[model samples]
Target: MALSHASLSLISMIFLAGSIVMLFFVILSGVTSTSPLSQTYFLRADTHGISGARAISQWTYFRICGDGNTDCSASYADPPVGYAWDGNPNNAPAELAGGHGGDTTSSSYFFMWRFGWVFYLIGLFFEVLTFGSGFLALCSRLGSAVSGLLSLISLVFLTVGVSLMTATFVKMRNAFVADGRDASVGTYAFGFSWGAWTALLISTILFCIGRHSNKADVPSSGRRWGRRSRSTRSHRSYEGRRVKEEYP
Candidate 1:
């Protein structure tokens, strides 16, 4: 069975709301000391030798936190590509030491996270625009088309952002493990990032479907109106002829 325009709009709004919530949580991770949220992070690793570094560190979007999210560092717009440790480069892992052909703190790593952060903000902005326009989708075909276009744009930005984030952390985790350090990825951050993307994708698709359905209904409605007009005109002509004959 085909869903009406209103029904599709409602479902799309629900998915868009879910996407917004997931993105908010991901962005706010490590910004506070609250349970569950505070625990959220991208990568966790044992960094034992570097000075000014915790024995175990969890990297979040805005800052690095010590084990169990205690003693978090000051937040930044674009977090340092390195672990923000201060000490002899030799004590740090080869992947992060940066003095002798290391990757961490390099221009490549720095730009990756920086651009990824920017993309996330951009994606969220467009998603909000899509949601606001979605209300019109319930009644107007143009509204559905506009909302779908905005959602597609949001999805593109989010895809790039999440891909960069995943690549950055996955490589960092692998580097730590290669150095015989325990490393793990954060489940909440990973799940939320992808989950939000999935929801936005679905919302975009539903908006398109609703738009097309509205278009399909127009011609049939016009045909029905045409047929009713023709029958009414013919009935009026017959009544006129009968009156003329009786009067003559």
Candidate 2:
């Protein structure tokens, strides 16, 4: 079935909008990773015991990754409470302290900001893919190219992208479970993973839609109506043409 040019454009715009929003949230998660409270909230929400080197009155706090003596990394801890971070495997990383179960590692915060970039980059790529495929199919008139590439991009990215995000969500959940913060929080966090799932589904739809040409007319009730149109017009003109006379 054919999609109107307007419909194709609308679908692309919707996909772009959704991708941008997802990218934005992913970036926000990264920026806020700088704060201990935000870090703790997510960690706890995922099920990890949140603690820090010393209790600070604030909701968030930052500390160096290893001994202040010498380490290239920094860490954020939350609940603004008692715990310590030493790179030492023996001092018991916050992830292991009290045999705590929640987040996989106090270590993850060290890399959490990267997730934002990952999301933004992937989202941007998918948006570009949608727009490019659409342009090839609609504007460039390379409809076949859209069909061929759209399937590949959609299948690979939609599946792999969702998988990566799901893995991260699961790791977070395990962390929370280990720490014993509150299972209810992880329930809400489920939306994070579900959102990715939704994005994948929408992408699949758009990708499939792009693979076909807009010029292909859909079978509609109007087909019979259109069939009658030519006949009726010709019948009315039939006698008129037959009556034509030559001028002297």
Would you estimate the TM-scores of all the predictions?
0.85, 0.48
**Model 2 per-residue lDDT at 105:** 37
Model 2 agreement with the true structure over 10-92: per-residue lDDT tens digits: 56546545654544443234234343213322222321223333211111123222211122123443211122332332322
Please give the distance, in angstroms, between residue 87's alpha carbon in candidate 2 and its true position after superposition. Answer: 1.7
lDDT of 1 by residue, 190-217 (tens): 8999999999999999999988873456
Error of 2 at 214 (Å): 5.5
Worst 10 contiguous positions by lDDT, candidate 1: 95-104
lDDT of 1 at 59: 88
Model 2 misplaced stretches (Cα beyond 4 Å): 30-42, 45-84, 89-124, 132-155, 168-172, 179-193, 214-248
lDDT scores for all predictions? 0.85, 0.41
